[model samples]
Target: MNRTLIPLAMALILCLLAATAPAADSHPGWFGVIADPGALTIRNGVAGRLSEYTVAIGDPVRPGQIVARIDPEQAAAQLAQMQAQIDAAEAELEGKKATTNSLQERLERILTRPDALSSGALAEMRGNLRTARAETRAAEARLAQQIQERELTRGKIAKTELRSPIQGHVVEYLANVGADLSTDAAVVRLRSAQPLVLRFAFDPRDAAAPSVGTRIRVQEDRSIGAPGNDTRSHTATVESLAMIVDEDSG
Candidate 1:
């Protein structure tokens, strides 16, 4: 019985030694993290068929750069129609003004030579002059209304252009050329190029997790197991921390 107990006691000692031993070549404070800029979806402000698609996945974009265009032909045509109406209205207004002036001249002539016309004829001439002036005012109002509509059509044409809101690379095309899009519809997705952020997960119980404003140095792990590979390093500051604990990690 003594000999059998000795072997079991030796086995327990070996297990303890293994559990306490430090892992080989492990570096302290080393953790894996990912670096990337977040994505943004670009949307259209007006509804129309896409006439131009000027970007694809992985294409670099600049702020205010035109990435797509909705077809402006409809708006342009509407504007043309409005302009024609305005022109016709202007011509009609001019004609009415000419008639009003001619009637005013005839009334003045009769007033200066009162005996040249009878009282009934004079009264009728005054009534005709008033009617002509009213018609002229109505024509002027119609012209003003047409001009306002033309300006509105011009505004619609301006909204057909779709531009990138930031400096980034395109990640996706939500709508393709010739596709009909509605107002506020997403046209493409982009990943921002500036201010790259580093993200990593850690145990919730860890007291050493970096807080906001803490500076950190990140080293690439590409050199691991490679004889002559050079490791890259980047410096960053912690800007935020997740408020909710990750259930799987925690």
Candidate 2:
């Protein structure tokens, strides 16, 4: 009976030591999901049949990179027509300027002529000069209008080419080559190569733990063994913490 009591006493002491020993601290902020801000869903601002697709999924993209082109046949035609109009207007303006210069030269010669008191002829010459000057000014204004119209047409022609707005990876092509697209139709999808953020939902009771500068580890799914293994998953620090409990989840 004494021997049995001694063994039981030893077991009790072992249990006490085990209970007093240091153990891993539990973190309630463990539950988290990755997030990305550079995930882009591209769309066409103009409507037309897709004429070309210059990129594919998983392709790297740069800002202002041309990713696709819509049918530009109509836009190009308008641009050409506007350009021709501008050319014609410019030619007319040059002709008007030349005529105005010639009329001014003739008026100067008439003024310098030795014949004095020719009031009637002088009045007629002055009237013809004013008419030429007015016509020249009108031609100048028309030329300016034509230039503006041509620039507008050029802008429309540029819209047919779709370009990426951000530098990132191409995730998908929503619209295929030769596919018809309406305004605001999605064209391509892209995401940044930068590291993604992890959002964790911490319990309200453990709110004090998730504070700014709190070091944390991000673990990948155990089934995949893709990250947090030999390669090791990315670790991060808490940048911010919510003070108020989420009403929707609560």
Candidate 3:
């Protein structure tokens, strides 16, 4: 009985020592890092001299707002030339179609009175009708192609207007009025107003502390000229946690 009591007393002392041990350090402070870039460059899709520039630096812009315009004179002139060609093709097609109709009528009349016309003359008239029909078809196709080209020119003219792709403040003007810009040339830079995401890196030893859904406090750097020039604090939640430790940082 005395030996059993001694073992029990030693086990109770070991349990008390284990309970008094210090826990792992879990620091909630994380350095500032943006998950998404704050600025985006807006570019034009067409190449031309800028005719109109509407936005300046520090101006607020919304999505689909027209901020710049390229000169549409060249594209518009191309469309006009194509339209004239299409008109001429249509007129020529009309003439060919009228000739085809006349030949068809003559062939029908001759067919009705076969005894009045020689076989050779009827064959020549049929061939002429076929030729007129072919000419008309060719003219129609040419007019269709010209119309398609006109539509493409009009589309190019439409693309001359550069619009903002996001809601943000215009940070810089990459191109000014009368500036020649190539296709995909940047027109303006904008800084988004979306909420910033914070990234925190911690030692792998304390990784168990910042699991998903953990609450954290972030202190903002005070700006010198900002209103009240006060330091701001923001509460952020741990949305995600990286399981793997970064070799260089950890």
Candidate 4:
């Protein structure tokens, strides 16, 4: 009876020690880093030989700043031709107006002198006046069309000068000076002037409990030499959660 009692007492003590042992603390959740940023791709909108490249990789740029230039010789020639056309049209219009005015003046003089003007002569003067007015109208239309063409050419020429779309850093140059570029050809890559994000992934089972903005702890891989070594833990708020599970991981 005594030996059996000793074994029972030993069993009771062991069970009590096992039950009293401290539980492992719950691991703080892990998350992947996500970068929230924008990238810009600069493109040549005009077709021409690239004349100048004013930006280099890693150069900071501002919006509306000119970063490159295409050859403007063609554009300049086009503008000059349009200007000459406009000048010719204007001169022709002026002549037509002058002729129209002279005819009117003669008709007025003849009408004032009733005996001096025959009915047939007056009818002929009226026909001449109508023709002069028609010529003036046609010349004015031509002038207007020339002006519009000149404006369009000027716009296209302006496009040959490439400008930064956003304030950022240049990441690449796709073409160099003297290179022929086609429309929509990429010229440079730019990174947005904004804060960077770190993207990371977490286990789906553990990810379900957290919502966006939920406070959590993050641990980065130690081998990567991320800042704050020895204190590898960071307090990060959840920004988002993935909706679908990755099938390959299953």
Q: Could you tell me every candidate's TM-score relative to the true structure?
A: 0.63, 0.63, 0.69, 0.67
lDDT of 1 by residue, 1-250 (tens): 1211110000011112222333223334545545444678888877889987788788999999888889998888889989988999999999999999999998998899979999999999999999999999999999999999898888888889778888888888898789988889989888875455556655434455556665555555676777888865555566666554333431
Model 2: lDDT of residue 217? 51
Model 3 gets an lDDT of 0.72
| Candidate 3: residue 243 Cα off by (Å) | 2.0
Of the pair 1 and 4, which is ahead by lDDT? 1
Top candidate when judged by lDDT against the true structure: 1
Per-candidate clashes, comma-separated: 0, 1, 0, 8
Candidate 4 lDDT over 1-250, as tens digits, reads 1211110000011112222333324765334453436677889887889998788788889999888899988888999999999998999999999999999998888888888878898888899999999999999999999999999999989999899988888888888779988889998778775543444555444534555665444444565555654524444454554454344542
Q: State how far residue 9 of model 4 sits from its true place (Å).
A: 54
Candidate 1 C-alpha error for residue 225, in Å: 38
In model 1, which runs have C-alpha deviations exceeding 4 angstroms?
Answer: 1-40, 191-208, 212-237, 240-250
Q: Model 1, poorest ten-residue lDDT window?
A: 4-13
Q: How accurate is candidate 4 locally (lDDT)?
A: 0.71
Question: In model 2, what are the clashing residue pairs, if there are any?
Answer: 228-233
Q: Which prediction has more favorable lDDT, 1 or 2?
A: 1
Query: What is the C-alpha lDDT profile of model 2 across 1-250, one tens digit per residue?
Result: 1211110000011112222333335743255555666688878877788988788788899999988898988778877888888889888888888988898998898788749538898888788889989999999898888888888767766888889888897888887789888878999888866555666655544444445665555554545545553423444656655444344552
Candidate 2: C-alpha lDDT: 0.70
Model 3: pairs clashing at backbone N, Cα or C within 3 Å: none
For model 3, the stretches where C-alpha displacement exceeds 4 angstroms are: 1-38, 198-200, 206-240, 245-250
